[model samples]
Structures are given as C-alpha cells and as structure tokens.
Target chain A: MVNTILIMAGVLMALGILLALFRFILGPDVTDRAIAFDVMTVSSISVIALIAYFAGRVIYLDVALVYGLLSFLSVVVIGRYIERGL
Target chain B: MEIRETVGAAVTLLGSVFIFLGGLGIVRMPDLFNRIQAGTKASTLGTILSLLGLAIMNEAWIWKLLVIIFFVLITNPISSNVISRAAHFRGTRMTNKTVADLLSDKNKKISEE
Candidate 1:
C-alpha cells in the first residue's frame, strides 16, 4: 500500500517538475526562474523518496536526505545572491 | 493491523490531495507570491504526511524519514520567503488579481517621500 502511494506521489512530482521546467524557461525574470527552480527541487525530492520506496532500499533514503539539504542550500545561495547582488 | 492500514490509506489519500494542490499552484498561480505560499504550504504538509505514511508502512525507514522531515521543515518556508522577497525586490510586478503588496508598497512609500 505504501509502495502504491509512493508511486502516485512519484507521478505527481514528475508532472510538477515538468511544469516547473516550463516556468524556468518561460519566466520573465531571474527571481521567477529561481522560484521555479525551488519548486523543482521540492518535486524532485518527493520523487526520489518515492523511488526509494519502490525499490525497497534504505540507501536511497540517505541520498534523498542529502538532496534535501543540498536543495535548501542552493535556494539560500540563490536567494542571497539575488538580494545582495544588487 | 486493520487500523494501521486504514490510517495509512487515509493519510496517503489526503497527502496526495495536498501534493496535487501544491503542484497545481506551481503550474497555475498567476504570481510569484501566490505560487510560493501555495506551493510551499501544500507540499510541505503533503510530503510530511507521505513521509509519515512511509515510516508507518515500513518501520525501518522511520529514522531516515524523520531526518528528511527535519530538513524539510526548516528549509521549505525559508526558501519561499527568500524567493518572494527577491521577486519583490527585482520589481517583477504582480498580476491585477493580487490584493496585497505588503513589502513593496511600503518600500515605494518610503522611496516616494
């Protein structure tokens, strides 16, 4: 049951990533692209965890954990650059 | 066992709805502020619940999931706020549907006077 639910999340996250990609491309400004990138990070995290469940591996959970941290760092760096670079 | 499975099923369904709402917000919201608020809140709730369901269904993964949740709780809103502030600073200009410009309007008044 968890596996099935994870798969559903994976599918939704994939769709969300694609939409975010569209935003990244079509966004009118750097900040818009940055927000889209942030969303993409989140969607990717959900997908990664779901795949871990599908494969029945605990190792991927660690990788997902790392990705979550990295995504946060990336967002912070980007945000700081945007705020202070002016 | 029955109750555990039932609770898992309910949470899973509700979590999916929240995730879907988060995704819809990302794709559909007309402005950055709206998208950030909707996307962050909905997805955070959704992912936390989903992680809880995973922990419940597969007990061994609970520790790792908890760690991931901790990271998520700290990062999600911070990123949203940072990006929204950046967008406001960059003068991205909101759609007509928006009712508030809490930060920008204040900045504008100060700069004007």
Candidate 2:
C-alpha cells in the first residue's frame, strides 16, 4: 500500500513539474515566470518530503526547509528588482 | 499500523493533487496576479499537507516537519504579496474585467497631494 501511494504521488509530482515548466517557459511577463518558479519550488519541497519518507531518511527534511528559505528569498529579490532599478 | 500508513499515504496523495492543480492554475490564469494568488494558496496548503503526511509516516521527524510547515506558511504569502506589489508598481497590465485598482487610486491621491 505504501509503495502504491509513493508511486501515485511521484506521478502527480511529475505532472505538476511539467505544468510548471510550461508556464515558466511560456509566461510572457517576468512576474509570470516568477510566480511559476515559486510554484515549482513549492512542488519540489513536497517531492523532497516524499523522498524522505520513501527512503526513511530525516536529512532530506532539512534540505526541504533550506530550499523553502532560498525560494522565498529569490522571489523577494526578483520582485524587488522588477519593482525598482535594483 | 497498516491503517495509519494508509491514511498517511492518502493524505500525501491528496496534497500532490493540489500541487498539480496549482501548476495548472499558474498555466491557465489570464493575468499575473491571478496566477500568483492561485499558485500561492494552493501550493502553500499542499506543501503543509504533504509535510504533515510525512510526519505521520515518520513519527520521529514530526518536529522537523512542523518547522517546515510553519516556514512555508509564513513565507508563501509574503513572497506572493511582494511579487504582486512589484508587478503592480512595474505597470503589469491587468485584465479588462478588473473593476477597481485601489493601489492606483492611492497612488493618484499621493501624486495629487
């Protein structure tokens, strides 16, 4: 049962990544791409969490946490740069 | 034990579904702000749910999962708000159906004063 769930979640994450990639590539505006990138990061965090569960490793959770922080910082910096000539 | 594992798996699966929907919304939304709103809310909740599910599966890592959830909750909205504000300031065009823009009105008042 656990294996089945892991497989299903992996498939869904793959689909989500594909959709996010489409938006990131096709988005007309910079902000649109920024939003798409944000979505991708969030999905990646979930994927990492799933991997941690599947592998029974706790270290990946720390990686997810760090990745979340980095994503937030990147989005904020990009937003600021877009708003002003920074 | 079997029941607990099943429940956790189900929750994680549901979270994945929401994440997928968030990506779909980002692709399909007509405007930038709409996409940000959709992506932010859905992804935030999906992430938290997935983390919670993982915690359920691994009881020893519950504290770490909770920390990640809290971090996500705080950061997601802040990043979305910053992006939307920046986009608005940069004159990203809104859809024609947008009835009112309070930020623009406020800016006008400031300029007039």
Best by lDDT: 2
Per-residue alpha-carbon lDDT of model 2 for A1-86, expressed as tens digits? 78898689878877987898899999999999898999999889999988888788899889999999999999999999988868
Q: In candidate 1, what are the lDDT values of residues B4-112, reduced to their tens digit? A: 7556645655665677677677678887877787777887887788777767767777888899988888889888888877777778878898777677778889999
| lDDT of each candidate versus the true structure | 0.75, 0.88
Interface RMSD of each: 2.2, 0.8
Task: Compose the digit string of candidate 1's lDDT tens values, residues A13-81.
Answer: 566677778878987777777777777776666667767877889999888888878888888888888
TM-score of chain B of each: 0.84, 0.95
Clashes of each: 0, 0
Predictions: Cα RMSD each: 2.4, 1.1
- After TM-score superposition, the amount by which residue B28's alpha carbon in candidate 1 deviates from its true location, in angstroms, is 1.2
Candidate 1 chain A lDDT trough over 10 residues, lowest sum: A1-10
Clashing pairs in 2: none
Q: What is the DockQ (computed on Cα atoms) for candidate 2?
A: 0.87
